[model samples]
Target chain A: MDNLNFDEPTRKELQTFIEREQAQSRYNSTVQNMTSMCWDKCVTGTPGNSFSRGEASCLANCVDRFLDASIFMTKTIQDQRARLQASQPETF
Target chain B: MASRKEAFMNTIRNEIALSNAQELLNKTNEKCYAKCITKPGTSLSGSEETCLARCMDRYMEAFSIVSRSYQTRLARERDASA
Candidate 1:
């Protein structure tokens, strides 16, 4: 990889481009995983021509609710850490 | 030099696109196989094939729906945090 001698600006450009692509790729993978999970939860019946209204709405809500659950869990952990640090301030 | 840089960027872009496509295909194969192939027969029956086709379509649709919902939620969270 070091054999390719790119100019500073070109290297920086490529670096940013790759970073953006990686972020996009990560976003795509999350969607794929959530789709599979929500499909199992909402799409119980055999595959029809189209999704029923209930199933479609359930799929949408499932994503939002899952994100909410993640945020809630993160906050809970942060709060627990804060409390622990407060109680044991000398443990530094 | 300019053309070399273009080629390098194109390679990276193509690799990402290929991997993304492969991931989607593998997932669809796993999911639809589970949903459609209830029993392993001598081969795939006609009804199972039909079901798999529909299942693949529905899975893609579901993916888009999820992507949109997640993007909207992420944007809202970012705004709130800001």
Candidate 2:
């Protein structure tokens, strides 16, 4: 194994890498979740030949739909907040 | 800690990290095999090999796509709350 010591430039690079990895920790979990979900949805074939066009579409759609769900939730919450503000009088 | 035993411990640590990567690789191989190779022939058939290759590609692609989407969602959620 190559020894990686903390020199100035190396240290800076490592710091950046660590930060990215930190962010990626959150990202990695979602990938696992999506893989599990999409595997169930798309990979129905008898594990032979290859993924059909249908399976590929299903995997892509699975990710898109999950994002759609989050977006829908955001809009719903915002609308509720707006309604509450409009109903409250003399708050200012 | 800079003794022979320390060096041995480091080797163990390195092995653990390598094994983790190996485990993922093995899992991906098994999963893609199951997805692409239905029948167990005397040898891997031509079509079975092609399917295995494609399944591996798609799996990696899906993993990356999911990673990106999840990160984007997290950023949006943070902005929304702030």
Candidate 3:
């Protein structure tokens, strides 16, 4: 491996390729994480041949609502920080 | 040089693919086992095998549903922010 030195152009190309692959891998892991989390929340009953309508919809909504909760919490934290900074200007 | 670059790229691609596959299999194993095997028996009974098979299919179906919903929400959020 030590003797394998890529030229400048090749290096740049590989850098972008690796970055793209890394982003894809991150996306995949996020999907995997949400799948398991939602499965636990939605699929409580015993396994059947197919999902009931209620279970299917619950699975879908679980994913959306989880993201919504995350965004809501982030906004709330930022708002709280702003209020604190505004109220205690001289604390710095 | 070109051949070496190709080899390197293929290695990275295969590694990522392999990891994603392993993660899915691990999740299926964990979830299906929990669902289908409520008690530890000396062996997997006939009904338990049926349940496990159904459970695996349903888990995968649920996974796809979650993936689609998440992707749609992400796109919507991106549009909103943009």
Candidate 4:
């Protein structure tokens, strides 16, 4: 609440700080999700003393491929939208 | 007061950090339990306990790996856009 009245510049600074923190938190949650997902997909065997060479690589590749897939899907959808607009220029 | 603003920002940062830690703990607990414990039992068997310990370690390792990969990707994308 307004328990602490922040001046205009201070408020703007705090807003920027919060936005940065939010971006960071979003990145962190994505990592958390990818970790859980890749752990399941890449780590099939029982937990050993340490990861095998293949397992380690698989974990790394999983994250990269997952992000690639996300970007690809977004691009695909945008392309589809562009195509639709081109085909139907007047359609709102 | 300037001190009050500093204190408020510190509180916000601390809360964010604490929540992040809580989230990691929750995910670790859920994933490790699922991986290590196939069936619910009155007590955790010896093998299940061992599996849980190893699973916890691996989960943390996986988190680090993903964090690294994501950071690398973010940097690459930023460089590309710039």
Candidate 5:
């Protein structure tokens, strides 16, 4: 509302706070997505009293391997970019 | 003015929290329904109800495990980059 004006420092602080919250929410959503995916993959049978040892390990490894894939893809893209830059001189 | 700003921030925080809860609930509903209610019946059978309960617990456990895995990976990545 019009009356909810935050001063410069307060506005900046609020911006940082919201950004942090957004980052956290993003992380949370990612985990939710991963949980659903891995649950489908690892928990094939009916839900039991507890996760089977295989299901538990699958969930853990799923997250780690997914992250590793993400990092590897990023590195691959960066390497390709470097190669492109080396191959062609920058005109603009 | 201070109280107004505080109220505004609280609203934003509450909204974010509310949406996060909503998302989790929706996902849980979808996943459990899929896993538990394979075929719709006149009503949820006793076994279906039990499966739903167990599915919910396992889903939550999976969420926590994934959360821990991601946090550890993030910390490791940060340390490596630093």
Candidate 6:
């Protein structure tokens, strides 16, 4: 594949296109995961043409809260690591 | 070489489309089966057919709602982080 499509500028273009596509693919999968998670939490009742007000709000809140929780946990872990480093002293 | 490249591009596009379609189909099947197949009858009845149709429509609606909600959240996060 590389040998067949070898040109300086064209190769650079294809590489960038591939990178963009890879990023989009990752972004898409994240969305898919979020959808599945939120759907399970929010859409518990029998399927209907319209969602009740409570269900709609739950769906919106689910996404925001999930992302918030993820960020908060990551920050908490980093903070704990920093605290540990600060507390431990090296004498050796 | 050009034809091969075209073929490769076509394959990628087709794969992406196929996966998206498969995802929709699976969601529809699971939701519809749950909603419509309440009782294992000798055959599919009229009410079950109606329920399955409505269920598919509702599933698509749920998909759109979730998609919008997530997209908005992503945009808001980007703005805040920026």
List per-prediction Cα lDDT, in the order shown: 0.92, 0.66, 0.92, 0.89, 0.88, 0.76
DockQ result, candidate 5: 0.79
lDDT of 3 by residue, A1-92 (tens): 33579988988999999899999999899999989998999899999999999999999999888888998999999999999999998984
Model 2 stretches with alpha carbons more than 4 Å out: A1-26, A43-61, A64-92, B1-20
TM-score of candidate 3 to 2 decimals: 0.95
Per-residue lDDT tens digits for candidate 5, residues A44-75, read: 99999999999999999999998789879999
Q: Better model by lDDT, 2 or 6? A: 6
Q: How would you order the candidates by lDDT, starting with the best?
A: 1, 3, 4, 5, 6, 2
Say which prediction, candidate 3 or candidate 5, comes out ahead on lDDT.
3
Q: DockQ, per-model, please?
A: 0.87, 0.21, 0.87, 0.78, 0.79, 0.49
Native contact recovery (fnat) for each candidate is 0.85, 0.29, 0.96, 0.69, 0.75, 0.40
Q: After superposition, how far is residue B51 of candidate 3 from its true place, in Å?
A: 1.0
- State the displacement of the C-alpha of residue A27, model 1, in Å, after optimal TM-score superposition: 1.1
lDDT at A4 for candidate 2? 43
lDDT value, candidate 1, whole model? 0.92
Ranking 1 against 5 by lDDT, winner:
1
As a TM-score, model 1 comes out at 0.94
Tens-digit lDDT track for model 2 on B11-76?
A: 655665565456556657878877766778789988878877777766676666566665666687
Q: Which segments of candidate 4 are over 4 A away from where they belong?
A: none
The residue pairs in collision within model 1 are none
lDDT of 4 by residue, B1-82 (tens): 6887788888888998999899999998998888899998999999999999998898899899889988888899999999
Off by over 4 Å in 1: none
lDDT of 3 by residue, B1-82 (tens): 9999999999999999999999999999999999899998999999999999999999889889988897898899899999
TM-scores, one per candidate: 0.94, 0.52, 0.95, 0.91, 0.88, 0.81
Any idea what lDDT model 3 has?
A: 0.92
| lDDT, candidate 4, A1-92, per-residue tens | 25568888888888898899899888888888899899889999888889999999999999889989998999999999999999999994
Worst 10 residues of 2 chain A by lDDT: A1-10
Summed backbone clashes in each candidate are: 0, 8, 0, 0, 0, 0
The residue-by-residue lDDT of candidate 6 on A17-80, one tens digit each, is 6677677667666766676677778878776677889988887788789988998999999999
